[model samples]
Each structure stands twice: as C-alpha cells, then as structure tokens.
Target: MSCSGCSNAVNRVLQKKEGVTSVDIDLEKQSVLVKTDDAVSYDDVLATIAKTGKKVNGGQVIA
Candidate 1:
C-alpha cells in the first residue's frame, strides 16, 4: 500500500474475514502478509483483498 490509510483500509477489510488471524503490511514492499486458518481459502483472501479496492499483483499460499 502507499500510505497508512491505504494499509489500514486493507487491514480492516482482511481482518473482517472469518478466519483471518493477523495482518501485516509492508508499505515499502507493497505487500501484505495475512495469517488465517483452514476456514479461509487462498481465493477467498484474494477476493477480500480486492474488496479494499487495491490492485493485487499476485498471491500464494505458504505452508
């Protein structure tokens, strides 16, 4: 994200998701690290991120 507001908006949207546990945003890297449970899926996370009105470059699942 570009600024704290942007990150906060994203964080808020992500945190509202069912299984989201934590959200870490690195503005310099323009990346967000989200921790979630099995109740959340990769696509679901992507969709939720999209709801923040940000362009998602890409995303992956980390074991």
Candidate 2:
C-alpha cells in the first residue's frame, strides 16, 4: 500500500469478508495484517485483497 487511501481500501475490503475480525495495514511495510476466525481461509483473504486491485508483494500467517 502506498498511502492512507490504499490502506483504507484494503481495510474496507477485508473487513467485509465472512470471517475477517479485524484488519491492520502497515503502509510503511506495505503489508496488511488480517485477523480472522477459524472459519476463514487464506485463499478467501487473498481473494478479498485481490478485489481491492492492490498488488500483494508478499504475505504470511503469524500462527
């Protein structure tokens, strides 16, 4: 993400997903930290980010 707008876009999109509990975008790191329940899948989260039209350079699950 480039700016607050970019982060907001990610936040808005991810928050609408089925099991996304929260979304935190770190513009500096160009990363999105998404919190979800067990019901959510990585593909679902990726698809949601894809909907925002932002290119994901990289990503990983914390646990």
Candidate 3:
C-alpha cells in the first residue's frame, strides 16, 4: 500500500467508490488508511480493490 503504484491504484479506484471521504498512504508503515462515512459498506471497499485489480491484504479497526 505504500508503493506509489499501489497508492495510485487505490486512489484511482476509490475515487469512484461512493462515500470515500479520504485516503492516506503511509510509506513508512506500508498501509493505506481509508476514511468514509457510515454510508460506505464493506462490500464497496472490496469492490473498489477489485476494480483496481488489487487485493486487500487485510484491514480492521481498533478502539
């Protein structure tokens, strides 16, 4: 996710997914941080990656 290509790929696909408020690519941590409203569904996230021809390695939120 930190690679420019990965970031660009995610951005290109996420831009089309609804309710995507922002995306942050952290090269140092090698992670893609995505933020969105409650309207955004998990399937939409998966679909976005699918559209981008990339796979979501894994993700989870912690309180």
Residue-level lDDT for 38 in candidate 3 = 87
Query: For residues 1-63, what per-residue lDDT tens digits would candidate 2 score against the true structure?
Result: 788988888898888888899887778878788999998888888888999898877777777
List the pairs of residues colliding in candidate 2.
none
State the lDDT of candidate 3 residue by residue for 1-63, as single tens digits: 657887788787787777988887776777777777888877777778777677677887532
Ranked by lDDT, top first = 1, 2, 3
Per-candidate TM-scores read 0.93, 0.88, 0.74
Return whichever of 2 and 3 wins on TM-score: 2
Worst 10 residues of 1 by lDDT: 51-60
Error of 1 at 32 (Å): 0.3
For model 2, what is the alpha-carbon lDDT of residue 40? Answer: 89
The better candidate by TM-score, 1 or 3, is 1
Model 2 scores a C-alpha lDDT of 0.85
Alpha-carbon lDDT, every model:
0.93, 0.85, 0.75
